[model samples]
Target: EALDGGPLARLHDGDLVRVDAVAGTLDVLTPGVLERPNVRPDLVANGYGTGRELFAIFRDHVGAAEAGATPFF
Candidate 1:
Protein backbone atom coordinates (compact mmCIF):
# COMPACT_ATOMS: atom_id res chain seq x y z
CA GLU A 1 0.00 0.00 0.00
CA ALA A 2 1.04 3.63 -0.44
CA LEU A 3 1.10 6.18 2.34
CA ASP A 4 2.00 9.23 0.31
CA GLY A 5 0.49 12.66 0.92
CA GLY A 6 -3.13 11.48 1.18
CA PRO A 7 -5.85 10.27 3.52
CA LEU A 8 -4.48 6.72 3.60
CA ALA A 9 -1.57 7.93 5.73
CA ARG A 10 -3.90 9.36 8.37
CA LEU A 11 -6.17 6.33 8.54
CA HIS A 12 -5.63 3.87 11.38
CA ASP A 13 -6.73 0.30 12.13
CA GLY A 14 -10.48 -0.27 12.51
CA ASP A 15 -11.33 3.04 10.86
CA LEU A 16 -14.13 3.04 8.32
CA VAL A 17 -13.47 4.26 4.77
CA ARG A 18 -15.51 4.66 1.61
CA VAL A 19 -14.32 5.16 -1.95
CA ASP A 20 -16.51 5.87 -4.96
CA ALA A 21 -14.52 6.21 -8.14
CA VAL A 22 -17.61 7.05 -10.18
CA ALA A 23 -18.47 9.90 -7.87
CA GLY A 24 -14.83 10.70 -7.27
CA THR A 25 -14.93 10.68 -3.49
CA LEU A 26 -13.08 9.29 -0.48
CA ASP A 27 -14.60 9.54 2.96
CA VAL A 28 -13.78 8.30 6.45
CA LEU A 29 -16.89 6.87 8.10
CA THR A 30 -15.35 6.46 11.54
CA PRO A 31 -16.16 9.27 13.98
CA GLY A 32 -13.30 11.48 15.10
CA VAL A 33 -11.05 9.79 12.58
CA LEU A 34 -9.10 12.95 11.93
CA GLU A 35 -8.92 13.78 15.63
CA ARG A 36 -6.51 10.92 16.19
CA PRO A 37 -2.80 11.54 16.11
CA ASN A 38 -1.15 11.79 12.73
CA VAL A 39 0.79 8.74 11.56
CA ARG A 40 3.99 9.82 9.87
CA PRO A 41 5.74 7.24 7.76
CA ASP A 42 9.52 6.82 7.49
CA LEU A 43 10.16 8.28 4.03
CA VAL A 44 13.96 8.50 4.31
CA ALA A 45 14.59 4.98 3.08
CA ASN A 46 12.30 5.53 0.07
CA GLY A 47 14.55 8.21 -1.41
CA TYR A 48 16.74 5.53 -3.04
CA GLY A 49 17.18 1.75 -3.19
CA THR A 50 14.62 -0.95 -2.25
CA GLY A 51 14.67 -2.25 -5.84
CA ARG A 52 13.41 1.04 -7.21
CA GLU A 53 15.99 1.01 -9.96
CA LEU A 54 13.93 -1.62 -11.79
CA PHE A 55 11.57 1.14 -12.93
CA ALA A 56 14.29 3.24 -14.49
CA ILE A 57 13.54 5.21 -17.68
CA PHE A 58 15.05 2.50 -19.90
CA ARG A 59 12.63 -0.18 -18.65
CA ASP A 60 9.38 -1.09 -20.41
CA HIS A 61 6.27 0.74 -19.22
CA VAL A 62 4.25 -0.93 -16.50
CA GLY A 63 0.46 -0.76 -16.67
CA ALA A 64 -1.55 0.90 -13.94
CA ALA A 65 -3.41 -1.08 -11.29
CA GLU A 66 -7.09 -0.81 -10.41
CA ALA A 67 -8.68 -0.36 -7.02
CA GLY A 68 -8.20 -4.02 -6.02
CA ALA A 69 -4.54 -3.86 -7.15
CA THR A 70 -5.39 -5.65 -10.40
CA PRO A 71 -3.22 -4.81 -13.35
CA PHE A 72 -4.93 -3.32 -16.39
CA PHE A 73 -6.01 -5.96 -18.89
Candidate 2:
Protein backbone atom coordinates (compact mmCIF):
# COMPACT_ATOMS: atom_id res chain seq x y z
CA GLU A 1 0.00 0.00 0.00
CA ALA A 2 1.14 3.55 -0.72
CA LEU A 3 1.71 5.20 2.61
CA ASP A 4 0.59 8.79 2.20
CA GLY A 5 0.37 9.33 5.98
CA GLY A 6 -3.16 10.72 5.74
CA PRO A 7 -6.01 8.65 7.24
CA LEU A 8 -4.33 5.24 7.32
CA ALA A 9 -1.54 6.28 9.65
CA ARG A 10 -2.31 3.38 11.92
CA LEU A 11 -1.90 0.71 9.24
CA HIS A 12 1.25 -1.38 9.17
CA ASP A 13 3.13 -3.40 6.55
CA GLY A 14 1.54 -6.82 7.16
CA ASP A 15 -1.86 -5.63 8.25
CA LEU A 16 -4.77 -7.10 6.35
CA VAL A 17 -7.19 -4.66 4.75
CA ARG A 18 -10.46 -5.08 2.95
CA VAL A 19 -11.49 -2.59 0.26
CA ASP A 20 -15.12 -2.32 -0.75
CA ALA A 21 -15.25 -0.22 -3.94
CA VAL A 22 -19.03 -0.32 -4.12
CA ALA A 23 -19.32 1.07 -0.59
CA GLY A 24 -16.29 3.33 -1.08
CA THR A 25 -14.61 2.39 2.16
CA LEU A 26 -11.64 0.48 3.57
CA ASP A 27 -11.80 -1.81 6.54
CA VAL A 28 -8.77 -2.70 8.60
CA LEU A 29 -8.98 -6.40 9.41
CA THR A 30 -6.30 -6.27 12.07
CA PRO A 31 -6.02 -3.33 14.45
CA GLY A 32 -2.99 -1.96 16.32
CA VAL A 33 -0.57 -2.77 13.53
CA LEU A 34 0.67 0.76 13.06
CA GLU A 35 3.99 1.33 11.38
CA ARG A 36 6.09 4.47 10.96
CA PRO A 37 6.05 6.07 7.53
CA ASN A 38 9.07 5.25 5.39
CA VAL A 39 9.54 8.42 3.38
CA ARG A 40 12.51 8.12 1.03
CA PRO A 41 14.51 11.27 0.39
CA ASP A 42 15.52 10.03 -3.06
CA LEU A 43 11.88 9.77 -4.11
CA VAL A 44 11.21 13.44 -3.34
CA ALA A 45 10.88 15.73 -6.36
CA ASN A 46 13.15 18.76 -6.49
CA GLY A 47 11.56 20.71 -9.36
CA TYR A 48 14.71 20.97 -11.49
CA GLY A 49 13.48 20.67 -15.04
CA THR A 50 12.68 23.05 -17.91
CA GLY A 51 9.09 24.38 -17.67
CA ARG A 52 8.64 22.29 -14.54
CA GLU A 53 8.61 25.41 -12.38
CA LEU A 54 5.54 26.64 -14.22
CA PHE A 55 3.39 23.88 -12.76
CA ALA A 56 4.80 24.21 -9.23
CA ILE A 57 1.80 26.25 -8.19
CA PHE A 58 -0.60 23.60 -9.38
CA ARG A 59 1.37 20.84 -7.70
CA ASP A 60 1.39 22.63 -4.41
CA HIS A 61 -2.21 23.84 -4.40
CA VAL A 62 -4.14 21.14 -6.20
CA GLY A 63 -6.53 19.03 -4.16
CA ALA A 64 -6.63 15.22 -4.06
CA ALA A 65 -6.59 13.41 -7.40
CA GLU A 66 -9.65 11.37 -6.39
CA ALA A 67 -11.46 14.65 -5.74
CA GLY A 68 -11.12 15.83 -9.39
CA ALA A 69 -7.64 17.43 -9.04
CA THR A 70 -8.96 20.92 -8.41
CA PRO A 71 -6.96 23.79 -6.94
CA PHE A 72 -7.41 24.64 -3.29
CA PHE A 73 -6.15 27.64 -1.37
Candidate 3:
Protein backbone atom coordinates (compact mmCIF):
# COMPACT_ATOMS: atom_id res chain seq x y z
CA GLU A 1 0.00 0.00 0.00
CA ALA A 2 1.11 3.57 -0.65
CA LEU A 3 1.75 5.85 2.29
CA ASP A 4 -0.16 9.01 2.93
CA GLY A 5 0.99 12.62 2.44
CA GLY A 6 3.61 13.90 0.04
CA PRO A 7 2.79 14.66 -3.64
CA LEU A 8 -0.50 12.81 -3.28
CA ALA A 9 -1.72 15.08 -0.48
CA ARG A 10 -1.38 18.20 -2.62
CA LEU A 11 -3.18 16.71 -5.62
CA HIS A 12 -5.89 14.90 -3.65
CA ASP A 13 -8.26 16.16 -0.98
CA GLY A 14 -7.51 13.41 1.58
CA ASP A 15 -4.39 11.53 2.60
CA LEU A 16 -2.29 9.60 0.03
CA VAL A 17 -3.07 6.01 0.90
CA ARG A 18 -1.69 3.10 -1.14
CA VAL A 19 -3.71 1.21 -3.66
CA ASP A 20 -4.33 -1.84 -1.44
CA ALA A 21 -6.68 -3.49 -3.90
CA VAL A 22 -8.01 -2.39 -7.28
CA ALA A 23 -9.90 -5.33 -8.73
CA GLY A 24 -12.90 -4.07 -10.65
CA THR A 25 -12.91 -1.33 -8.02
CA LEU A 26 -10.49 0.58 -5.80
CA ASP A 27 -10.14 -0.77 -2.28
CA VAL A 28 -8.37 1.88 -0.21
CA LEU A 29 -7.90 1.95 3.53
CA THR A 30 -6.69 5.12 5.18
CA PRO A 31 -6.65 6.35 8.76
CA GLY A 32 -10.32 7.03 8.19
CA VAL A 33 -12.82 6.13 5.47
CA LEU A 34 -14.65 9.13 4.08
CA GLU A 35 -14.79 8.49 0.34
CA ARG A 36 -15.67 5.82 -2.17
CA PRO A 37 -14.72 4.79 -5.68
CA ASN A 38 -16.17 6.61 -8.64
CA VAL A 39 -15.71 3.90 -11.25
CA ARG A 40 -14.53 0.32 -11.56
CA PRO A 41 -11.38 -1.06 -13.15
CA ASP A 42 -10.63 -4.04 -15.34
CA LEU A 43 -8.14 -5.92 -13.18
CA VAL A 44 -6.73 -5.69 -9.67
CA ALA A 45 -3.33 -6.07 -8.07
CA ASN A 46 -1.69 -6.16 -4.63
CA GLY A 47 1.70 -4.83 -3.53
CA TYR A 48 3.46 -3.37 -0.49
CA GLY A 49 6.29 -0.90 0.09
CA THR A 50 7.26 2.13 2.11
CA GLY A 51 4.15 4.22 2.66
CA ARG A 52 5.76 7.61 3.22
CA GLU A 53 9.27 8.91 2.92
CA LEU A 54 8.94 12.23 4.72
CA PHE A 55 8.62 10.62 8.14
CA ALA A 56 11.96 8.92 7.65
CA ILE A 57 13.59 12.21 6.70
CA PHE A 58 12.16 13.94 9.75
CA ARG A 59 13.14 11.10 12.04
CA ASP A 60 16.69 11.08 10.73
CA HIS A 61 16.99 14.84 11.00
CA VAL A 62 15.76 14.87 14.61
CA GLY A 63 17.52 11.66 15.63
CA ALA A 64 20.98 12.78 14.52
CA ALA A 65 21.38 15.56 17.12
CA GLU A 66 20.43 13.95 20.41
CA ALA A 67 23.08 15.48 22.80
CA GLY A 68 22.89 12.31 24.92
CA ALA A 69 20.91 14.16 27.58
CA THR A 70 18.16 12.71 29.73
CA PRO A 71 15.09 14.29 31.27
CA PHE A 72 14.87 14.79 35.06
CA PHE A 73 11.29 15.27 35.91
Q: Give the number of the best model, judged by lDDT.
A: 2
> What TM-score quantifies how close candidate 1 is to the native fold?
0.47
Q: Give the C-alpha lDDT of model 1.
A: 0.61
Residue pairs in collision within model 3: 2-18, 3-51
Where model 2 places Cα greater than 4 Å from the true spot, the runs are 1-5, 33-59, 64-73
lDDT of each: 0.61, 0.65, 0.36
Each candidate: RMSD? 7.2, 5.5, 16.3
Compute the lDDT of residue 3 as modeled in candidate 3.
Answer: 27
| Each prediction's TM-score versus the true structure | 0.47, 0.42, 0.18
Question: What's model 3's overall lDDT?
Answer: 0.36
lDDT of 3 by residue, 1-73 (tens): 0122222223335555555354533344464444432333322232223654534444333421134322221
RMSD of 3: 16.3
**What does candidate 1's lDDT look like per residue over 1-73, in tens digits?**
3343355667878888998999988889988766666667876555458876664432223333334443433
Cα miss at 48, model 1 (Å)? Answer: 7.8
lDDT of 2 by residue, 1-73 (tens): 2335454655657889999999988888785544445553343566658888887888667776578768763
Model 1 pairs whose backbones collide: none
